[model samples]
Target chain A: MKLPRRRPASPKKTAVGGSPEATRAALLQAATAVFVASGYEQARVRDIAERAGANVAAINYHFGSKEALYLEVLRRQASERIERYPLPDPAQSATPEAALQAALTMLLSRLLADDQRGFVPKLLMRELLAPSAALPAMVQDVIAPQFRQLSAVVTALLGPRADAATIQRCTFSLVSQCMFYLFARPLVQTLAPQTYDDGAVARLSAHIAQFSLGALRAQRELLERADA
Target chain B: MKLPRRRPASPKKTAVGGSPEATRAALLQAATAVFVASGYEQARVRDIAERAGANVAAINYHFGSKEALYLEVLRRQASERIERYPLPDPAQSATPEAALQAALTMLLSRLLADDQRGFVPKLLMRELLAPSAALPAMVQDVIAPQFRQLSAVVTALLGPRADAATIQRCTFSLVSQCMFYLFARPLVQTLAPQTYDDGAVARLSAHIAQFSLGALRAQRELLERADA
Candidate 1:
């Protein structure tokens, strides 16, 4: 059952060399597909190995177990998102508003942009709904850092003295605006097919930035008024 | 494997009498669970019927097939949400601002409220991700109408003269905030475990309402300034 298939390991021939590195890369790609499709309990290790045109022993040798292989897919996916759409360094923008806008733009790109691991959102979303052991790593390694980054920009935009809860809520609000595009893709595709297009993403970025900044400024004024 | 169990349908005995209505209800309950867990493709009629303490023929007798049963769950789930948390009647609010806030409140409540059928979000979420046959009914019967209603509130808040795109974007922004509380529940739970609690829901509700309204009002003022 673990025999390598004569056919290519997918269209890209990710396992071209059949070397350990190539086999590991091939396994990650195949494991991601299988995991996203069948989830944790149902996904079979043999299927993943077959998809990668490698032996099951390779999965054990390289990743130790199926859980470790799944974790690698997630970790790689998280890093790739940052690499592909790095948040505009907070300092790069000339003003607080620009910084926020830049962040939103990059975020929209990261969420909307599809790469090799396009299934990451669905994979993570499943875990979110029905948490497994992975929920902690996802929160700590990926989500926590991203939320903090957004919170910092939001705090700067709202003024340094913004209360913690308010900053957190604001951060959640801003991230959700971008996240909805990816998270609710199926429903959006069914109802409004045009939203995922690049043009739409760009437009959405502008609207969210302006709308968020607009709201923050308004909230600031209201707070100041109450203070006065 | 599809044999009818002789048990009394323990617990509520949703199918106690084996009456058509009771059987149907029982099937819906059990189907909701299986479908939410395994999705459309993976869910089996035998599992659902057994869970509901009925037989396979009862599924055929009551809902026609697994697909029909799944569709009924979505339709009922959709209607139940509207019934449980109907959008605030438009006339009750003296102003558009109040109308939008009320609507946001309703949406958050609908999203966050867990009842006898707390699995609705997860069920709908899986469909939204993979989207088998039920996507159309979900969009048409549930999601679209709600969006139009929110768009109307956004239009009123932005003033009747606001263009279509701005209103649409604003509506998406507002809905995403609430949906995030539901959509990103896993991540939210991991980081801000307080969000789902009653106190957090109320506070978050207030924050989203004000944040959205504040942004709209600020945008209104900016538009006016530009016009002047």
Candidate 2:
């Protein structure tokens, strides 16, 4: 039986070269498409090999197993986006507020800007809803580090007044606000009905930054008042 | 072909009386389980009928068509939750702050409180990610009205300074904050590792209320300062 096809055929063609590197690259690309279309478990290794025009033996030779291939796909997809939209180094921004805004802008760009054709965001979202065995590795390798980076920024913004838990919750708030755009895109489109054109990421980034910074500042004040 | 079963058999037994009303209720319950498991298009009327202990012809006799049955499931689920967690009557609170807090608390309760076994929340989350034909009607019947109600509360809180678009965006911010806990539950669980016990809803509601109210107040102050 033909598996149900959800995504359009990828325009990217596997390289014709019979070299090992070329075959491996083709396998990764094919695996990504199959994984995105069929999810991790339903994705068949045979189908991926057929799509890549590679031998079944090539998969095990290159990646050892389907699980390893999936992990590689996730790691590569996540790293590529992070490299493209890296948060600014701490010293780059003049102030914590500036740093926070830059971080939100980059984070929004990462989450919403390239979401069309993006695989990691979709995979991670699926992982959130019905987590697979890969979730712990993902949280460890990707999510935890991102959380710590955001936590640092929240700490700087909230200053010494807020405790660790407060910082953590505020970090969740900031990330959640940004993610809502991607996860709830359909509802957002229906309600707002605007062109999510090139300017959308920057525009949304501004709104989130303004709202979040204001909240962080307010939280700090409340904590200060309580201390007094 | 044996269909993959995702959910355990619902404890709700079809009424033995074989009355039309009883049959319809049973179908709704079975359809909710099937729809939630297989989604809209893949869900089979035959399976739903068997699960409900009714005849396949009974579905058409009661609800007219599969499309109608699906819509009825969505409608009933949405309305039940709304009725249970209706937004504050506008006059119920003396201050907009109190009103907004009450609204947030109720909204959070609605979104997060009964979500564990709730069919509607699961179905709605599916709608957000992979929208089906019923999306427009669900948006029109359920989402639009909810947006308007939230808009009213945001308008009252933002005072006269913020415009319609600002009010709309702020409303999205408020809602996105509450929904994050639901959509991102696994991530929240992985990072926090705490039991989402009974108190989780009220605690999360308090955090969102504080963060959002603070943002709205700050937004108003910014606009007021600009006017100065």
Task: Show model 1 residue runs off by greater than 4 Å.
Answer: A1-27, A30-72, B1-15, B41-44, B199-201
Say which candidate scores most in TM-score. 1
True contacts kept of each: 0.82, 0.62
Q: For residues B1-228, could you state the per-residue lDDT of candidate 1 as single tens digits?
A: 454433444344345444567777778889888887777778899999888878889888888877888888778877877777777777789988788777877777777777745566777777766667777777787678778889888887887557777787888899899899888887777667777776656788789889998999877777667767
lDDT string for model 2 (A1-228, tens) is 553232333233444255667789889989999887667766899999988978888999999999999989888887787677666787788999988888888777777765436677777777776677878887786677778878999999898878988898899999998889988888898877793667998888899899888888899999999999
Each model's TM-score, in the order given? Answer: 0.84, 0.81
Residues A135-218 of candidate 1: C-alpha lDDT, one tens digit per residue:
787677656767777888888877755788888888999999998988887776765677777686678899999999989997
Q: What is the DockQ of the complex in model 2?
A: 0.47
What class would a CAPRI assessor give candidate 2's docking? acceptable
Clashing residue pairs in candidate 1 are none
**B1-228 in candidate 2: lDDT tens per residue?**
544322434234454244566678889989988997777766899999988888899899999999899989888888887787776776788988887778778777777776536666677787876677877877786667767878898898888888888898888898888888888888888888672677987788788889888898999998789888
